[model samples]
Target chain A: MSLLEFLDYSGVAVFAATGALAASRKELDLIGFLFLAAVTGIGGGTLRDLILGQAPVFWVMRPTYVVVCVAMGVLVFFTAHLFESRYRLLVWLDAIGLSAYCVMGAAKGLAATASPTVAIVTGTMTAAFGGILRDILANEPSVLLRPEIYVTAALSGAALFTLSSEMGAPLWLASLAGAILAFGVRGGALAFGWTFPPYKARPGRHPDDVM
Target chain B: MSLLEFLDYSGVAVFAATGALAASRKELDLIGFLFLAAVTGIGGGTLRDLILGQAPVFWVMRPTYVVVCVAMGVLVFFTAHLFESRYRLLVWLDAIGLSAYCVMGAAKGLAATASPTVAIVTGTMTAAFGGILRDILANEPSVLLRPEIYVTAALSGAALFTLSSEMGAPLWLASLAGAILAFGVRGGALAFGWTFPPYKARPGRHPDDVM
Candidate 1:
């Protein structure tokens, strides 16, 4: 597989794992855990595709991602008791997925000829929006509105990627650099318990996050 | 306002009311009702915005729609218990909103110079999609996924609008014709208990819906 494709799979796997972990927190059974994981992992991309006027969505078009997520979900279900820590592993995986998906989305946006600003927004949004949707569907507050720096981290990485492209950086270099930056920002948030202030909080949590 | 805008607002009002009623079924508070109402009312439009690459979203841009939905939600919260028959009210309002939004979406797609097939799809999607998202959030099976004529009705209206537009019908007439068709189809389903047959029932109920 190409590097980009490989990274995409990695991102999906990590995100799915984190989703399963979250589902386990809800005391969900194996299938429930897998179901949530797949839904959370794919929710953002589905929204992105629908909005971009792309037909069938990525996961819908390529059902293999579905298979992978379900498989991962099944494994996590049977062995959920193994990872009973307070989200440390899941947090790390989430960071990796966030960075990886950010790079992939930003690269894809630029390839689609989006303007620099739009590209960054599209990329970062693609990276973080699905988790936000999943949280809302699961009746949890979105990480986006929590001042938790999730979107900010994605944004910073997206900006760096775009800037690197403008500076004539190669795809590999740009992606690697941007992913690191995203990981750093999000990692910092996880390690230090960083969050934005509450001025931007939506009423009773996110309104459009459900959509 | 022109008749078109009048129709649009009316559709929004009806859809919003239906959303509030749905929330009432769960015994959610006023704010929750508003959240659900606003989403069900404008969710399709928001989806359309993303597809059209319209930024910040309509409710975000206008803000009034949010106010309207919130106000309607408050109204429903107080009056919901007073209604002896909520089922009929929600269903009919849903029908009206679905019809109006379907035609409106088609018109927007046409105005954007989108391809005819795309326009038809966009129109129908714009009308019904928000409800689909709402159902997911509400932990219910999407009406679209069922053997219901919901999406099919939207498709029918969208096709009508596309054909009328191609034949050079005036915008008002075309939209009216299309919307009436959609309303008729949906109304027929509600009256006659229409449903889509299951595609093999999928072994067992996917336990995810239980949550």
Candidate 2:
């Protein structure tokens, strides 16, 4: 398989594992694990394809991706308890998936739209939206609302990839650099609890008064 | 406009109003209200189109649907506080949208897929998924998890429409009957607190043991 294809499959598997772990925490049944895993594995790409007008979507074109997700869900279901810190493992696995998806999504976006701004936005959405769906379905607090820098890493990675490609970098080099930068930023957040400042509402500003 | 077309637009507007009210409850800014309104208005149709392989999606093709949603957001932003019970209004508006979407979604699905089962599923999703997305984005407990018969109402409406059409009923008659059934079921739930029995897990059945 090509490097990009390999990354795509691995990213789907890793994200599915994280989803299964989430299901385990919720004490859901096997069906729940499979459902969550499948959704988290492919939700981002599905949304991206819909927005970009890619008919049949990625998984509908290649059902192997769903098989891979189901396999990860089954694997995680039996073995989740063996891990001492499943949450930590889920976070790290998600980081890996995020990095890969950002570059791949950006590459696909650039190819389809030929617009760097759209590519960056699609890339970020591809990386982060699956996790958002996972959290929402599992009734967990959204990763988007967390203090740590999650989406920022995906956005930056996508931006970097778009910039590098625009600057005439080789495809492989751009992909590698983008993935590494994303993983590094997310790693820093996990290791050091790095975060952006939370938004503080102005006390006197009312909703009705704003518009 | 045709009756179906009119219902579709009304559904979008009503759904958007509910979404704007959700944003109001969260005390979000104008942008947040618009974003939530747009998403809640079109999310279900977007998903249905993607699954049915309809390229460009409904809103992208019309664009007027999005304009309707934005108008609702702006109107609700300024006028939301005037309602004595915003939640009750939101629920009633949502019920109206749900009933319309179920029939519309079923019709579209049957036209696209030529399968009654697919039509029913798509109809239910079109009716309910937008509200699910709204609640998730607004951090409200999902209507799906509520004891009330929400999805069941959508599902029955879709099924009824598909069945009536298959039985040689006129399009308008089938549509009206299906919509009224959905609304009646939902209204019964709201007025009488009707609910399906909750799922009960069997004791000693473990996830690992299931498969």
TM-score of only chain B in every candidate structure: 0.88, 0.94
For every model shown, the clashing-pair count is 5, 0
**Number of the top-ranking candidate, with TM-score as the measure:** 2
Model 1, runs deviating above 4 Å: A1-106, A109-211, B196-198, B201-211
- For candidate 2, the per-residue lDDT at A83 reads 95
- On residues B1-211, what C-alpha lDDT tens digit does candidate 2 reach at each position? 8878877898899999989888777665565566578778988888888788886577656667877988999898888777666778889899999999999999999988889999999999989999998998878878888888999999989999999998999989889899999999999999899988877667877545643
Please give each candidate's TM-score.
0.55, 0.60
- Summarize candidate 2's per-residue lDDT along A1-211 as a digit string, tens digits: 8777877898788989989989999999999999999999998888888777985799999999999999999999999999999999999999999998998889888887677866776787689888888998999987755667787788789989999999999988888899999999999999999875432223544433310
Give the poorly placed runs of model 2, Cα more than 4 Å off.
Answer: A1-45, A55-131, A134-140, A143-211, B196-211
Candidate 1 CAPRI classification by DockQ: incorrect
**Structure candidate 1, residue pairs in collision:** A44-A130, A147-A196, B147-B195, B147-B196, B148-B196
lDDT of 2 at A134: 92
lDDT per residue (tens digit) for residues A1-211 in model 1: 8767877787787788778766655544454455557766766666656655664456644657766777777776666555435256666787888898888778777876667876797779989975775565445556666555788888989889988987899888888899899999999898887877656566688745655
